[model samples]
Target: MANQTSSLRSRGMEMLIAYKNQPSVELRNRLVRLNAGLVRKIAHRVSHQCSEPYEDLEQIGYLGLIRAIERFNPVQGCAFSSFAVPYIRGEMLHFLRDRGTTVKIPRRWQDLQKEAQKCQGEMIRQLGRQPNDHEMAQALCVSVEEWREVKMANKNRMPLSLDATVCHQIDSSITLGDTLPDTYYQRMQLLEEDRQQLQRAMAQLEDKTRSAIEYVFFNGLSRKEVAERIGVSPMTVTRRIQRGIDQMVAFLQPQALQTEP
Candidate 1:
């Protein structure tokens, strides 16, 4: 009885695949309606690996399955399931990659993140519980808007491990904190080097241009403020800023391409 049931299922799948490949819209719609649940299940399985909403992925996956049905070639002898799995997965990934938000955070955001983390740690220690956003903002000496931006930026980051366990105590070697401090120092040194290089690059600009950039970006000043500081009209300051940015982009483009992995 099991053997007969298995044979019937296989025959049914083959017939469905054939009908789906037919040029008639009615037959194709019928085939899709029949396999709709299967397609949804496949989408759910693939979407588990992604951070995007699953309903959107399911819609994308269904479109891929429809395309697969339209393009399937029985003469090639490739099983429909094998071809459909990759097609469905590719569609969902394409949707996620293309539709997701792309945020280009300013470099100053890093400083904000560090300050927020330090404040959060202190609050947790004092309160013996997680601090609310308002409490964290007050502790960090930042406005609520700034605090929220930092919190959102770091929301996806994983927490650091607090384990004091030693991996190897063979030679009564260095403690974990000692090793961590060295790594932290190395990272700080690298960051300092990068800052120096960027500073040097900025120094290459004209004095007024450099001042405009520094006021507008580094000091977070508006164009009017920059103009006032430099004793120039706001429009002049704006033009100088644009020219400075163009030069910087030209200078950095080559370096960026070289550094890309």
Candidate 2:
């Protein structure tokens, strides 16, 4: 087994040298085929106990493997597998961070986080102390409540460990999974009902108002984002949102009260 492994490595290195200079697509594909197992190995390692689809992880890992092939230096005194493993694993991790969440974050929240970090640093230097949300909001020319929402959204970007214990009972222990919002069937049922009710209410709204509500809430966009998407001013988007909410309440509230025990 060791002798076969050594021979394969030698052949791979020879192919690398030839391909680096001539750069044949055929040679590159051959290299990928030879080392495809490496990609799967790295993918499996990175995704251990993760719920992400194995095929998707492997595809991401293949991208990293290709990157490694393009950049590997024979003179770096490292084996090809050693050089490629990090790249493959890094790609998988990057994919998980960007796309693994059940609730997809809005791009606006990510942009807001960047702006908040920049403004927080500058304000701290100017004031010689950490600025509060109100100060930050005033500097950013946003409302304090809006600033708080942004901050909370940014804070939620950090992924929590599932294995973390949420509670300790007399005879057993409960993990964070046990307490997660997703674990509640009752809550999910209620949410589904609310979603159906909202959809029905939205169907009754004007086209423009419906679009505004969908953009702001369902699409996870800010009022400004909704305005830009719909080719309207932010103030107009806000009015539409308010009117939509009022209409939804009028349409759904009586039903909700009737269902109350």
Candidate 3:
């Protein structure tokens, strides 16, 4: 098993080098498949933290993997997996946010966050030690997952001020907002690129799957309504929409990656 793993790693590096030297559709596609295991591992980690399906997360992770492949610089002496992880996780986070995973946290969860912090401080004062998740959950009268969810929800709710200073030595005058794209042209270009990419991704989906997604997301139909329109069960329609999203992530390869000027 060790030998096989080493061989695969070596083969992946060789492929990366070849792709870097001369990018091609075949080479890029091979790299996507080669590093697919990495995507699954990340998806597993991310899926455990959220309510998203493992399969959908895995597919969304592929979109990040492809983006990483396009921007990777092997000469930088860093492992590709490490470079790709943030991209993979970022894609999953974006998907979650789009799906409304971080909407207004419930009142109970808000109270839970405050109470948990107080409880932790009290426990540490008494025990002179940090409490484990199970201990914290037990004290809070919530399950471990519930405790984690409350914390995550609270964290997501905290918004950073754009005017807050982020850098110290690199000109203290620079603020967080300064880092954002300010030019009208830049914003429009980015929006256009994103629009084109999304259109292309949707175009790549199966006709039935695309119709199901469009009816529900675009046409604002309920799952049952979409099902009736598509002549499929509501449950099947749900699966199709998820499957379509997964395919879109893979199909979201940027136009520049397809060919160079």
Q: What are the lDDT scores of the predictions, listed in order?
A: 0.75, 0.85, 0.87
Whole-model lDDT, candidate 2? 0.85
| lDDT of model 3 at position 140 | 95
Candidate 3 lDDT over 125-217, as tens digits, reads 988999888888999999999988987887787777899888767545778998887799788998998888888889988899999999989
Any residue pairs clashing in model 2, and if so which?
A: none
When summed lDDT is taken over every stretch of 10 residues in candidate 1, the lowest stretch is 156-165
lDDT of 1: 0.75
Model 2 lDDT tens row, 110-228: 56667778888888899999998889888878899988888777667567889888889999999987776765787889899988988899999999999998887788999988888
- As a TM-score, model 2 comes out at 0.39
Alpha-carbon error at 210 in model 3, in Å? Answer: 64
lDDT, residue 149, model 2: 82
Q: How would the candidate models be sorted by TM-score, starting from the highest?
A: 3, 2, 1
Model 1, residue 241: what's the lDDT? 90
Query: Using alpha carbons, what is the TM-score of model 1?
Result: 0.39
Listed per candidate, the RMSD to the true structure in angstroms reads 22.7, 23.1, 24.3
